[model samples]
Target chain A: MDSVTALGLVAAVLTTGSFLPQAIKTWKTKSTKDVSIVMYLLLCTGIILWTAYGFLIGSIPVIAANVVSFIFTFAILALKIKYK
Target chain B: MDSVTALGLVAAVLTTGSFLPQAIKTWKTKSTKDVSIVMYLLLCTGIILWTAYGFLIGSIPVIAANVVSFIFTFAILALKIKYK
Candidate 1:
């Protein structure tokens, strides 16, 4: 890919991957107390919108990142509800 | 703005604004226990890169969103350090 795409991909990876550890921790610890319910709710909604926007724009980087992020956010959201 | 730009702006607003409540809560509660240190660190770095990428690409929506996000992440990161 070109440099711009590479930059976007790298940015996407770092931002998206940042959530992985938290999701795993939440899963293992069954703790969503510290994780803000409002934040997750908003984030999940935002991720869905971002994914749709990415699709509309035909941006692979945005689509790929948001897809993974959507899953992670959904996972966190589910845990938030379950643990609440 | 055009439709594509409007879509991107909306997407950016949602995703970036999602963090505002968390940042405000953290500022008020002074709690970073549930907030993942690793996530914020990586996210802050990613936001910086995204801002730079946005600048390079001349994307006003991306730049605007990432700038706001960067500020919130920085606040969270600072709290994470102080409260750790």
Candidate 2:
């Protein structure tokens, strides 16, 4: 892969993978009180749109990163609602 | 701008703007107990890399988005540190 694409992939992995720990923490603790609902709601919506944008641009890295990101954000969103 | 670029800008705005409320909430509440330090640290690092990647790729939207994103993430990181 070209350097720019590789950089994008690395950026994607770092940004997207960062959420995993938060999701897991929230899951294990069942405490999303400090996690703002408004923020997650907006984030979840934005991530869906990001995935669409990624698809439009035909960037597999963006698409793949956002899809995984959407899952994690959705999980946090769901957990927030459940534990609320 | 072309449709793809416009879409990208919209996606960037949505995602980046989503963080504002969280930052505000944290600032007002002064409670970041549930905010995972690992997640924010990784996110902040990723955002810095994203800004660099955007510069490398010559995407103004990406660069602008990531700069704002980095500020917000850094704010959260600072708050988490102070309140921890």
Candidate 3:
């Protein structure tokens, strides 16, 4: 792929992967006291829209990043609700 | 602008705006025990790359979203570090 696309892919991977730590932490600790549920709620909704936007724009990086992000964020949100 | 762009803008707003709540919560609570420091570190780094990617792609939505996201995430990271 082109360098720009490569850059976007890298960015996508980093941003998408960033959520994993939070999800794992919450899972391991089972503590959501300091975690903001509102943030995850809006984040999940936003990610779904971001996925739709990616599809609309035909951007593979955007679509891939957001789909994975949704999974991670959804898990965190579920944990937040369960532990809240 | 076009509908797809509009949708992307909306998606950008939601995702970027989502961080505000977390930042505010951290600031108010001054508690980072439940928050994952690694997550914010990764997120801030990823956001910087995402902003660069946005510039490379010439996407206004991406640029705007990441810029705002960076601010919020960075603030949270700072707070996390300070409280931790």
* Model 1, span A1-84: residue lDDT tens: 789878987898999998887888788888776677888888888888888888988888789899999898788889989997
Decide which is better by lDDT, 2 or 3: 3
Off by over 4 Å in 2: none
Question: Which pairs of residues collide in model 2?
Answer: none
The global Cα lDDT (0 to 1) of model 2 is 0.88
Instruction: Kindly list the per-residue Cα lDDT of model 3 for residues A12-50, writing each as its tens digit.
Output: 788899999999999999999999999999999989998
TM-scores, all models, native as reference: 0.93, 0.95, 0.96
Q: How accurate locally is residue A18 in candidate 1, as Cα lDDT from 0 to 100?
A: 85
Ranking, lDDT, top scorer first: 3, 2, 1
Q: Give the distance in Å from residue B68's predicted Cα in candidate 3 to where it truly belongs.
A: 0.9
Tens-digit lDDT track of model 3 for B1-84: 899888877888888999999999999999989898888888888888888888988887678888899999999999998999
Residues forming the 10-long window of minimal summed lDDT in candidate 2 chain B: B4-13
DockQ of each: 0.70, 0.78, 0.84
Question: What residue pairs clash in candidate 3, if any at all?
Answer: none
Model 1 residue-pair collision total: 0
B1-84: candidate 2 lDDT, tens digit per residue: 898877777778888988888899899999988888998998998898899998998988789999999999899889989997
Better of 1 and 2 by DockQ: 2
Model 2 DockQ, alpha carbons vs. true complex: 0.78
